[model samples]
Target: MAESRNEPADPIVRGTFATAKQSWADLFKWKQRVAVTNDYGETYCEWQSPRPLRNPISLFAQLSARDWLFFLVGLAAWTADAFDFHALSIQTVKLAKYYDTSKTNVTTAITLTLLLRSIGAAMFGLAGDKFGRKYPMVVNMIVLGLLQVATIYSSTFTQFLAVRSLFGLFMGGVYGNAIAMALENCPVDARGLMSGILQQGYSLGYVIAASCNLGVGGSTDSWKTVFWIGTGLSIGVGLIRLLFPESKQFIAAKEAGGGHTSSSPRAFWIETRKMLAQQWRMCIYCIILMTFFNYFSHTSQDSYTTFMLTQKELNNAAASRASIIMKTGACVGGTIIGYISQWFGRRRAIIVSAIVSGLLIPAWILPTTERSLSATGFFMQFFVQGAWGVIPIHLNELSPPAYRSSFPGITYQLGNMISSPSAQIVNAIAEHRTVTAVDGQPAPAYGPTMGVATAIIALGIAVTTALGPERRGRQFELAKPAGVATADEIEVKGKLNDVESQVAVDGEKPDVGQMENVIVDDDDDDDEKKR
Candidate 1:
């Protein structure tokens, strides 16, 4: 029943916004529309009934043992990545003092890392597609662990920046591979829940980092201990990855002739070229989408604790406590909203979250006391990250199989690169407006600056997501490896991956196309049973 992609037909429709501004006159009336049809024959104004949402409990129960393993491993990798990165952000004040520099100078380390991650994503994502998911991921995690150790030993601000810049590259590579490893073979019925849980790894990392900050570095000059802890976790995650095999989706793709075609480096270039040639528009759109997303997250989070400590003049413990509360909300909200996205649709869920987040900006920033700020931070992040929960599955569904690693990873990192200076930009803006702290030192007006920036970014995300297409429940089972699946086949077959049949974990064969098997390995006799 899915549309074919072996040949070009028409673009998927979200709305007419993209084309409306081709000329000034047409732009004025761009909103006017006629009945138009997508390749799937769904009309623009069709009144379809809402898809029913799955019970969260039942959805979790449906996963096979392999599915759980893949999910947990991927989650750990992502969580560690976040933990390592946020350690730097959380220690900006201590880092500045340690290196005898301004807070902005210390924050430049964050900017440099963000700037270079696209390069890392490119390097490792190619390796992922060329080789397999496991080794490349292992390499990335190991390098990240080493870099964290290097950060702890940096003798100068320049050295610290250099180490973190290198760290960014390796850090950038993990997201694409992690999401692909976790969700590529996930059951269609459970993807929303899994996506939600996976995205929370970032928030979970922030919470853990805050807890560490409170426990290890509270009023102590020992920011080095935090970095050391991050290094240990990163190394531990790398080792953990070794215990799990490569993703079944990657295994099946390889066996079916995707990456298995050639061992030469040229094969990586050729495959990447072909994927971009067909999916360039989607890639560009995703980058633009990610630009707003990264801006929303970094703008809201990276400078928040500083804002609390410096501008609000709160104690270290109070700032850390508030951050933990905010990120905890982020974790809980992302999970709930991600699950809701299964039936509510990706774009709709994102827009709704964005709207609510924008509405909460006043309370998020206006609260003066630590207790009020903690409450506001919790609700604010709940919506901000609730929108983010949809991103993993949304991006995964948008990606072509051949370059699953490269497409999403590169695009996301590129977006990160574009928005890399968010903290600095906000800091620069805040510098123009100063306030006297209770301790008599001058502080930037971080609360007002962040409040304004978050509101605008929230609106931007809502509009962008509204105008973007959604591929909910897209198929993942392919008839052949990605190398053999033509553009036409990829586009037409979409997420279904041409797995015309499905076998359940219970050993009862489902009707053809009724369900997807999430745990079928290539060597299994049940390979056919899954698809």
Candidate 2:
């Protein structure tokens, strides 16, 4: 036999190892590099690298003028959408009186608005993927503005309901599209803050609505004036949106034949099926959890604040004033929660807020003088329902880009649809309980029922947190890379690589200890793991 062969030069093996080492170095250096090679093309750079800038201050410093302007555009769109919704909130009680209906009937209208808005959201979501974000957003605004103008002339309950429901359809498009537009426009590192800031528009709109409704004096028709103002604002925004540029990512995806143009009926159906199969469970859970609590909170707090006050023996004017105070508190409270989420992380922030809100619900059941109840009502919105401040942002983040609009649209609408009926349920229950005007105190039954619902919903939220993913600072692309390894493939390849590398370095068989160490280190902690 020939002399025992010395190890060959193994140039290919050496080159592969060297390439791997370089890749490892780049990964550690905080720069991301992607090398793409096709039949006639090759390029490499740190185009996909994610920078580490977590705080608002850092985000502000780093964003370009274009990015800043895009953010402002997002804020304006969201503010307009939120302003329209909350204006309805302020006018709900007054509308009830105008229609010669109970507070419960008004609550039903609010519920229908939410439900129909979800339908609008789903329609726009599909449309956003089919067309582009820009045109659809403009369409939604124009439609909503027109509807608002029509709502001004709604003289009958059917006409009012029909106009509001139609408006809801377009309202759906506003939040989802605005969120998609905002998130896609921001740099990956600044995503959380930018998204959080955009969400603040809702609170700001609430404040504007409260101020406008409070300052303006009118009969039932005065509510029409509010709709007219909303119409004007929406129309102005729609004109601005018509001028806004399409997102770069959206444009690129379209150019690559990977976006709207590439979609086919068969492909769309398949994608829909996949989305339903993969995501429907989570969607159902979210809808159930959100519906129970959101309906309870909104109807009890926003929709029925005036009615609740009247039940407690306050005059109609006093009840209306009390509702304004509660809305003011909501504005202040929601803004605080938005900032707090930036600090504590979204999931934890929501969990803590929910629990605290649950604890505060029992306070509604306690005995209080009229003056005390009004005071409590003002702060109650700040604390007892503050968790909702984070919801629009939270729901948007929980979804994947592929079906972001669809998933949120379905779940949110479903929740609203389910909650719509609660107005009737709660009213029926309150009617059943005796309301002896003793010491100017309303019956405690409604409060106790609300408190129980709050606690149960809080528990549901806490449990859901266990199943929810932590996406606070992660890059959205990393969560769902284009044409990359599946999650399972990544796990398997990572394990095999560890084994092969360990065997090569030691010049011996792989040791179990090495495998054990890899398992322990690679496994994320339960609290920190992505959902």
Candidate 3:
């Protein structure tokens, strides 16, 4: 047999700029159905909302027991990564005190961590794709555990920054592997709900880290205790991953000879370059979207506790409590909004959430009392993370079919890289401007700085989301090369030429509804074997 058959090209999808003229008209054209293609082609139709809403439970029931286990494990790994990273962020106050440096200087660790993550994402993400998701993730988590411990040991600010920079590298790889492993096996309709829950792993991490800070007390050295807790979480996730098999989808694709699953170095590079050539546009768009999103979360959150501690004169315990409450709202909103995106359409949900968050910015920071601040912070994160809930699935759908792991991971982290300066900038601006603290002493003007910055970011998120492309239900694992089949896909029903499409002869592409699966995933999992 020939080493490989000719691979079919991706479908023609509209780029963001190409659709700009109709952007205004398209907003009102919600009734139009989204156009889809079997392979990338020369022309395509506009993005639109789907027709009917489905019950979230009914949509959720589509996954097999096997799917649930994999998803939960993926989520655990992601949560651990978040927990490890946020441990440092939530402890910024104590770290500055412990190091006897300015708060702006302490934020340098956060900046270094965020900046290095893009490199880690690119390295580990590609490793997950070319080799397998399991090992890259396992290594990332364990190394992260070590780094957390290292952070606890650092004797100087320079040592701390260096350790955090290393921490960001491993931490960056978790998102791509976790989402690919979690969502690739899920049924199409369940993706929005699941993506929401998965993305909340970050918010959930923040809540837990804040709670850890509260439990450890406000001693300057208490930050190390939180880091210790982070160490346990990271190591624990790494060990837990060791118990699982390779992704069932990865295994299936390999057996079927369908995906770019070749473990060969030569095969991997060839496929990688081709995917980039075809997918560069989608890559740039995802990066730009993620830049705004990373900025959205960091600007509003990283300095929040500091804002409370200084401007509002809340004690550390109170600031931590408010943060927990805020992220709890984030958890709830992400789950609910993610579920709604199933029927509401991904882009629309994001736009509405971003806009609502902008309107809430005034209240989010203006509150002077602990309870009021907690309430506003809670509502603010609900919309903020609710907008974020769509991202995991959105990036996956927009990725090159075979490059899902690296594409989503790289773009998301690159966005993180671009927005890496968020915390430092916020700290810098807050320190310069003066505000009257509750104690009647002059303090850094955190409240107004956060409000103005967040409002601008919220508006940007809304507009960027509106103008971007979405492929809500793209099949990551199922789609095979179009117009070509491996000799292994024995179940393909038509002649090789006819399989190209019955209407291709007339120079017209068939409707997506008329397309066939052509191949089923490897039925080797226990659930499928039992069937």
Candidate 4:
């Protein structure tokens, strides 16, 4: 009877060579039967059996259909955000020219926009956690679209700055909400790819904005036309999202009383306090590190590239064209890095990209002709600046589902808050390097100073890599499984069980509540029925 039960049923397995890799079932059975004997001449079986095979067909089908829709929504939102943000970069120089202001002053407008956007991101993140992602995303799109349209008619520098700053606030909400939507909707196996695809919208938006700037012609009205284009795009995205459904996870959370029900200010604060107290440390660390590196890359590349092009004496038209080219490189680089990170592992990919790009930064400082400078700038932006496209997805994975949006939003915004100032600082430093020649031409004094600053920041990042844990290929869940132990749990359990077994196996007194089985019925059940 034992021989019949143990007989190899599958001929494919029986005919395999001894050196062939073992099947999962064969390996699992072997592991179950093996027991290590201690010095005391006693052996014990491993607790818990292997899990049963899960049905992949149903899981794959559901994830495939749902994640695609989620990806589209994320893509649209991010693309709009990218268009709104990068459109302003080229426009800033134009704004400086039109208002008879210094580029430094114009750069301050960019800083204000970023600062306000960070505020929006943080606020909306909290709101998304409190309420839900869908409403905030829809509201932000409407707000940003209307604001972009309003930006077109601004006459004065203050008006433009105010409008853009307000737009930044709305833009901020889009990111956190969109990310939360994507993260919650995607399957575990495809989260990285979905996140990457969604983030590609930023790069794609840059491309679209650049094309618009170049295609529209760099008149004073050209920037305004670009803003109108952004408004239209945002409206389209908003309308598309209206047709899309809310996240299943979010809906389930709301049904389970895991989300807010009241609108009182005090109640809001209490909920915020609870979230912060529970996950503040992890949230803060991840946000600071990820955002610092992300913003550092973007500000250094996007802002500095425009600065460099203008310094090279390119006209607004030429510079805008060059900016478009740089943005193209960024798009390509972002797409490549996003996909590569999936294969190489997110942390390793980020570290490697940072290191390689850091090495390339010094090249920007090297003396080069206009052609060489443009080529080098494009390469740097594509590889170095593009590396940031993966951080959002990686950061999202590290956070728990309940606090996912809030945590990434806080971390991303806080990092942006710290790093946005670097743009102004870099501009200030670069300004110091400018010298007026005898012929009345302003010459660039520090050719590669921004690159040097970036390299230093990259070095800091290399040191801080230790602070982040490896989350690649790990399943993201609200809580770890209870009875189904992980490897880490098994090790800890073995240590505790060894101690407990020593007493129990030797007929010594057991500790209080040490028995495996314990049952307690709920008194509340009867009381609730009586009530």
Candidate 5:
């Protein structure tokens, strides 16, 4: 006897593992919502389910060459951003000696950088949304390069802190712009894998910093060399961005909105206020999710080198080497887990990775010797960053319509602001407390401190991610105003000048009744397939 329909009714309620499992199956079996805009031009969206996940090559092949350029440049920019920040973090011990201050005091710079990033997120993120992703990022990247050099010449600790604070401000803007540019153009189904590879740019930057640190050997002045390298890298990325055109999605969205990103200050403020009104709850929820993630990474990573030095009794070179390997694991895990998330579902991927990483806390910290510690640390960060891989696409998916740059950027960095003291807190606790080490000697207890904090943070990430909203396979393409040609249909496709002129000539008041395709779809109106 065949059942009348193959699928069960949508779960009456949610928040259970069984429910989540059922929903995962539904992602494949049912027709997911496809975003559609009505004549009123409201942000409400009705979308269809996505096609099945494709191979990495197939997914990548769908992108135009223009898309690849944007993604690669965005990744390069993010990598440079990571290097600039990690230059200080990995050099904490030497910086302490150079400044003649305690490691806790030195981490204050990290705190300041994190604390003020929200401001940059608000300012630059809004600019990216309103103006475009290009110029704001150019300004941010170039300024960041200059700030790194300022870190080199500071004669006093206070001056160093000031420069780093400014650095944080500029740095705050990078993630939002970079991620938006990178993933905004990617295919809906491929974003999971693309996001994973993209996020590893951070880890890649960290690895570059560590490698440079290792090359210079352990010296009080060696950190400056790394900063100089960062200066060049940042400036180079800024220059490279000049060659690329603005994101096609951003263009389509603006054109869809009648030829401007926002036509006037009054309009921009009105839109911002309206978005805030509709999405306040989602905003608060994302901030909470990002808070847990920020804590997860900073607690586990920022002090690990110091932990090895103080508790495990490793030298600077050995510690740096192990760190390189650990983050290498981060790169590998992020890519693999990120790719898998495409088919597995975003929340499920993040939840499982977080849980496994939490369970691996013991193996991560217990090893005594260099080889053993390296192996353990590598495995530990694999899961730590595996969860992180999904963040770029996840945040983009959660962002409100037309505010991708500002919303995700602000929330993410706001989380950073809240968790700014993570490294400082870990250091303050570890430096003062003592626990038995693998050698049976009483040590600063760095391992215990990081382990407990990361475990709690991991659990928090899983729950927050589970409870939050996901818009996987949501569309970023918008309908063209009637009579306006699409990007492909442009006379000189992919040329910046040709596209702008076309937009200027063709974009005008549309017949609201005739308009089709919309980029900014906030909620799925009939998401029965994903239920």
Candidate 6:
């Protein structure tokens, strides 16, 4: 096995939140090192380095037909998940009025959904790992479709809450399975770009839901029609997935004896326990990264429109337009930044994006006019989601291949669970700082709350990402060594053929784990003296 400690240890140590301290010096320090050695025995060392940039177009060109198919299906499933989720959120007032209940009660349904999703993510993640990504995802979609339809027909607030809560469970499952299926089969070089595109499914779904609401929500109880539309789309995506074969990567892993050995539940749990023991640290790290990520996204976005409407005093039409602008920036930024991460390195790309996004918070929230708000929102999300675009690939690279579905999925959902209270926290803080409106009514100053929350979350993400390990361009496909019993321990599949083997002059192990297949072929020119 390759030694894993080639990269410099992160400065900000991770432990209990209360005990941890950020290393400000390390935050600005450049740590990457490049080395060169002479072929002839003249000097001890030679150093050369190449530019770390690559053409983005080549990222997509490297993928296969099957890779494209998997990416599309994965993107669609996640998009549908977003669509079904936001469908209820955008129509909360309508639902509350229809059911003759307080809006908070309706919002509680959203909370219930968030609270229960982690359970669903775990259960379905296990199923996907055990069975295959396809079937579990298909089942999740089907259930989501049924629940969405159920939500539409709910006659009582209790029924609506119950159905929506159930919807959250199935919704949680889709992300893990969808991302696993999409990126698992993808070429390693293309993963960053692909991840960027895939993550945008959420933004795309929001746009779709918004569009649907605009089209049908003018009449009384027209929100039901939106749910019906979301339902049909969910079922259609599930059926569409059935048309495709299981991910070749999953099939390969299964045939190579990756997951559980026996088809029994007992075996599944045993294997689960075994893998957990090996990957617990990685799991904790992933959950931490995801918590910051989720907070970064939700704190900035969930109350953005409210900030524009209540604080900036924009009307509904202006706020809606600004939202569109913001999400559009997200879609564009996620794709571009994801592509950039292929060359920039995942950690660097994410850190830079977070920092830039943090800097933009002032302009993002302080704008008084709708035009300024839209422009700032556009640029703000570009950086925010740009950082997010790398997450799917980043998580997959860190995950054990045997539990790719469960590991990333469960970690993501847990992060969601942890940050579920972000909006509430922001609301509470903003509500306490209410200002007198032009109409003599008290209104919360949402701008400053969002600005502060977004800035803090961005800085937190930067610290987490900088200190975190990266496996940029790590290979996803590797054959299990025979009699290995578990795929987790399987040796990386391919080797670098170009570099001739060279001994380490400094008697240090080469940074093998992080290198895709590139071995440093180095020879010390002063070898005789050294020897």
lDDT of 1 at 161: 84
What are the clashing pairs of model 6? 36-46, 41-525
Report the lDDT tens digits of candidate 1 across residue range 54-158: 778888888889988888888999999999889989878887788888888888988999999999888888777667789999989998999988988888777
Q: lDDT tens string, model 4, 400-495?
A: 555677667767766776666666776677777875432357865434657777787777665455334434544444322111233333444555
> On lDDT, who's better, 4 or 6?
6
RMSD of each: 11.1, 14.6, 9.6, 12.7, 9.1, 11.1
TM-score of each: 0.82, 0.71, 0.86, 0.73, 0.83, 0.80
Error of 6 at 198 (Å): 0.7
lDDT of each: 0.80, 0.62, 0.82, 0.64, 0.83, 0.75
Q: Pick the winner on TM-score between candidates 1 and 4.
A: 1
- After superposing all C-alphas onto the true structure, candidate 6 shows an RMSD in angstroms of 11.1
Model 5: how far is 153 from its true place, Å? 0.1
- Kindly report which residue stretches of model 6 are placed more than 4 angstroms away from their true locations once superposed: 1-52, 100-102, 217-220, 257-264, 436-441, 479-531
- Candidate 5 lDDT by residue in tens digits, 1-531: 222232223422234455445445544443532344345553433434445667789888988999999999999999999999899999998999999999999999999999999999999889888788899999999999999989999999999999999999999999999999899888877788999999999899999999999999998998899999999999999999987888898788767633532255666777688878877777888899899999998999999998898898888899999999999999999998998887677777898999999999998888878898889888888988999999998888778767888888899999999999999999998978998876778989889999999999999888777655566766555522122343333422324454456567899644333222121121131244247
TM-score of 5: 0.83
Task: Write down the worst ten-residue block by lDDT for model 6.
Answer: 41-50
Off by over 4 Å in 1: 1-50, 257-264, 436-442, 479-531
What candidate 4 gets wrong by more than 4 Å, as runs, is 1-63, 255-271, 365-371, 435-442, 477-531
Clashes of each: 13, 1, 7, 1, 13, 2
- Summing lDDT over every window of 10 consecutive residues in candidate 4, give the lowest-scoring window: 1-10
